[model samples]
Target: MATFTPPPTDTMRAKLLLAAREEFAAVGITGARIERIAASSSSNKAQIFHYFGSKEGLFDALYAQTLAETLALVPLDAEDLPEYAGRLHDAAVQRPWAQRLVTWYRLERGDAAPMEAVVASNAEAVAEIERAQRAGVLPRTLRPAVLLGLVVHLAAFWSETSPEFDTLVTAMMPARRRQVVVDAVAALVRR
Candidate 1:
């Protein structure tokens, strides 16, 4: 009998990313072990270093990947800020690990280079909010950047905030939590 092997490609990269994501989300970068990531991915530490250069490099790659994936999947709807916030809340709920990964990134690598994609996306969103404000759809009192930040923060409030508060909020149904996010965003942007 012959042993089988999987060819190396993006699939391997994805497996490593997924494994690393779980590890990092669970214990953060400082505490996550490359050995565990390797074992989980059916890969080895050498491959991880070869692909990402180091543990920090792997974390950077994973952070970039997570941000891009989230932006692509849960795009902002400038035409409807409340709906956009609701969708963001839904995305946070559906991919709870993603918010945790982001939390880990902030805690572990606060001084790292900003993800350019996220910066550009935020710029675009700010521009859209500005347009909406000028068109009288959204209130002009608040700065566009501030409005965007508020909506984004509202969407991830429970996940990124205090664990004790999160436990209480989690007791409510997901729909209620989502509604709260949407309502908060709506109130902020209301004329």
Candidate 2:
């Protein structure tokens, strides 16, 4: 959505990215196959190659877009970490693939791919939290980055849980799940 360099406007490329998002999230980068992706998008391997050059290239583009959308949609609110965490939970629920893609990104890319968007976003959020702490808006108990990391992880309680944990919390409806994230962050911030 940047004016300087927006996503490719080609319809075929868009379709491929859409199809690739699901494929990568479901199977991850190593498991994703160009043939399946092409079939899903009604495109062939040649077209995908022409557009993205390779599987890794396609995955990188989609992941970058996914992260950019998250940043744009969920700007951090350091002063209100509880509500910010709740919003993040809502976003994960709305776009399940987003969370899955993040997991895949970490497992595969690791530190090899340091996304500029994520680094800048984390720096900005940490700065905001520090400012808020100095102003007495947020507690000074935890380091800004640790507090931010805690809040972010708490928001993904439902998304990152084990299968056993998932079964145990099956009855915790969406509203309650969101409230749990917000309340947990609130408790952390209170300290």
Candidate 3:
């Protein structure tokens, strides 16, 4: 007979974390139901507590993980700001999870700890921007945080949200117009 080995509990807990991220991104923490999150992970509420201590604890873990993951996606190379911009634009187009997680965090304001993840991530990006400015790749006057903000906040408007936004971008705008808008933003960042 083949021996059977159970998957590690941490592995199961990790699944819960991922499910929580998706759920919180969709529903916001206030609106996200624990049962649904559990159902998605094929776990129960008791297991959630065992892993995270509580729903709020689960939210904190999700928020931290989401911030870390999103920050990891940022391209901070001085020579590759354009590529970075393109990457960010593509992320907005491709991975809506980061934006949704951020939206949920902003709306819920659930984390009790200081937003250290944000400051750390931005600081690293700022260091990279400073390098870009020194290299004359980015404009000397552009603040890294401001540039990052523009990339994230503006791209988010187009990428996420109501059906109206999708209709306007998908059905209303001509292909040329859509391309033009994207090009304009890229040009603004490059200049």
TM-score of candidate 2 against the unseen true structure: 0.89
Tens-digit lDDT track of model 1 for 6-118 = 65778889999999999998999999999999999999999899899999999989988888888899887877989898988888888888998888888888888887877
Residue lDDT tens for model 3, 1-191 = 99977559988888999899888878888888899989999888988988889887898788787667655776555565545555565666666777777677766774456678667877887787777777787776657778756655544555555886566567544334435445654676665
lDDT at position 39, candidate 3: 97
- Report, for every candidate in turn, its global Cα lDDT versus the true structure: 0.87, 0.90, 0.71
Model 2 CA lDDT for position 97: 99
For candidate 1, list the clashing residue pairs, or say none. Answer: none
* Residue 113 Cα positional deviation in candidate 3, in Å, after optimal superposition: 3.7
Model 2, 54-148: lDDT tens per residue?
Answer: 99889888988897898788888888999999999999999999999989989998857687877887798899999999999999999999998
**TM-score per candidate:** 0.91, 0.89, 0.78
Q: What is the lDDT of residue 130 in candidate 2?
A: 98
Q: List the residue pairs that clash in candidate 3.
A: none
- Top candidate (TM-score): 1
Off by more than 4 A, model 2? 1-9
- Model 1 lDDT, full chain set: 0.87
